[model samples]
Target: MSENASATELTSQYTAQVTADLERNTKEQERVGVEIAALQEQLASLQRDHTVLVNIQQAIDAVPVPDSTAPPSGNVPVPAPRKKAAPSGRAERTRPSKKTRPSRKTAAQPAQTAGQTAGKSTGKSAGKSAGKPSAGKAEAVQTAQATLVDLVRRHLTEQSEPRSAAEIATALGQAHPERAIKTTVIRTTLEGLVAKTQAQRSKQGSSVFYTAADPSRSAATARSEEQPEPADA
Candidate 1:
């Protein structure tokens, strides 16, 4: 009977130890699963950031490179390079230079003076020629008589639908190749016209559009105002 009880106690202790071990293993597995989920979330975030960076890089790379040798617009002249000054020190004053200085009355002086005079005359003539083109441009502008605002009004009236400032400026440019029309100028003019009740303004998304006000309504209002109010009844 003592031997059987000792064996039964040993079996019970072994089963309890196995149960405790299984509980610890389950807890460890739960902790590992939580860590894995956290790591997966971090990995997803990193992937999203990586995609954004790649798209930005692609956009930057797709930009066109400007021509290096192309001259910029406008006839602004490039300045000449400055001449280097002679070194001022006591180290090399004794040695005579290989290049001799010419006297004021040398033949080279007369030739240089003549060349300088010719250059001055040429510069004056060029300035006069440039002035003529500007004068002609002013004359043409005066001859146009119709201001930019008038042009914009005409364009808006001609179109059945409202037009953006950029569209109106493009149309103005096409119609008048001699004029340099800017979208900003057109937008400001449209806004001014709106303030004056000459045009109606509307906005769609980020774009602003303009349309001519109804002339019939304005004419009717003018006529009503001009008519006497039945001598105040």
Candidate 2:
């Protein structure tokens, strides 16, 4: 009786295991079916979009071009159409390709751009002859000189008197105490001003006194204006 009971328990366990495995397989199949359905739907959508694109391309290809040269009567002077190539039995694959050669007229023309180079050189020489200084160097010197002259003019206008190189250097030194002002530079600038007729130089013992010249005045008035104010009574 115990043997029969053991056999019956084993059969029941095997049947239960088979039932569980069948249920798991069915769930897997259902999941796979759902994924396949989604892929099919995506494929269908892509095919529809592709068909629409093809149709759009066909429509664009079919569009007719308007002839602007045609009058309201639709007649226009279009060029004669090229004749179709004659049908030949000499197999297209066997035909010898023609060699491309430049025309004799084009080949005979000079390649050296002599005219362009000559024009450019001539222009440069003319520019140089027109009292133009060396490009960057001359511009820089002129700019610096203008700035210095402007400063000196401002100083003289403020004081209503001409400044000696030493006096100008001293003032500059005080204004920019960190910078060194060479005596030579101040003297050169003063000489340039005198040469330009902006300032007049007079001898006073061994030292030279510089004065601003009045552009529109006679010599006597300029001399009188140069005198110091009289003492208070």
Candidate 3:
């Protein structure tokens, strides 16, 4: 009787140990999954930032830096000829020749006026051009704010049927060959969209598909089209 009781006690302790280990393993898996998801989101954010920075850097690099130190092309001044001092009582009435200086102030007046005019024109043109890039940057920021999830949502919106993650990734990859859009990332992004209720998922046999969720005001067009609408009352 003691032997049977001892065996039963041993079985209970083993079962309890197995149950505890299983619960710990499940918790650990949940924690790791959450961490991985967070890491992926951070990675996607960094990648988007990197792309924007590279574009801004390239735009900045494209602008030619004005060389402030270099002298203007043809503005070198000619030195005036110096005259010797006359001796005492000598006829020192030396008339400066017409060739010596040509109507100095009158000559420079038109040139200075023209220069000011040119400066004003260039300043206006520069101001106009500078304003353009700021507008472009604003547009770029607006576009950049549309992240991978938005893109996926947009793609789904464009489609009339449900799509698998691989198909979505392939279509995006084809559209933006420069971007290395992976199926796994697309799938994860889709899952995020699903969680937000921005997208919907359906299962057909072993295959799962996704589509953009309809607005609250409207019924799902895809489902309506694929399935039949009820006869109007």
TM-scores for every candidate against the unseen true structure: 0.34, 0.29, 0.52
Candidate 3, which segments miss by more than 4 Å at Cα? 1-39, 54-108, 121-146, 217-233
lDDT of 3 at 126: 63
Per-residue lDDT tens digits of candidate 1, residues 107-200?
A: 3565556656666666677577546645654554455334566677889889999999889989899999876788876776776666556788
Candidate 2 accuracy as lDDT: 0.58
- Cα deviation in Å at residue 118, candidate 2? 62
CA lDDT of every candidate: 0.69, 0.58, 0.74
Best by TM-score: 3
Between prediction 1 and prediction 3, which has the larger lDDT? 3
Better of 1 and 3 by TM-score: 3
Q: Per-residue lDDT for 38 in model 2? A: 39
- Ranking, lDDT, top scorer first: 3, 1, 2
Say what the RMSD of model 2 is: 45.2
lDDT tens digits by residue: candidate 2, 114-190: 44455566566656544332343345434332244555555555656656778877887686565456555556656
lDDT of 1: 0.69
Superior by TM-score: candidate 2 or candidate 3: 3
Task: Give the better candidate number (1 or 2) by TM-score.
Answer: 1
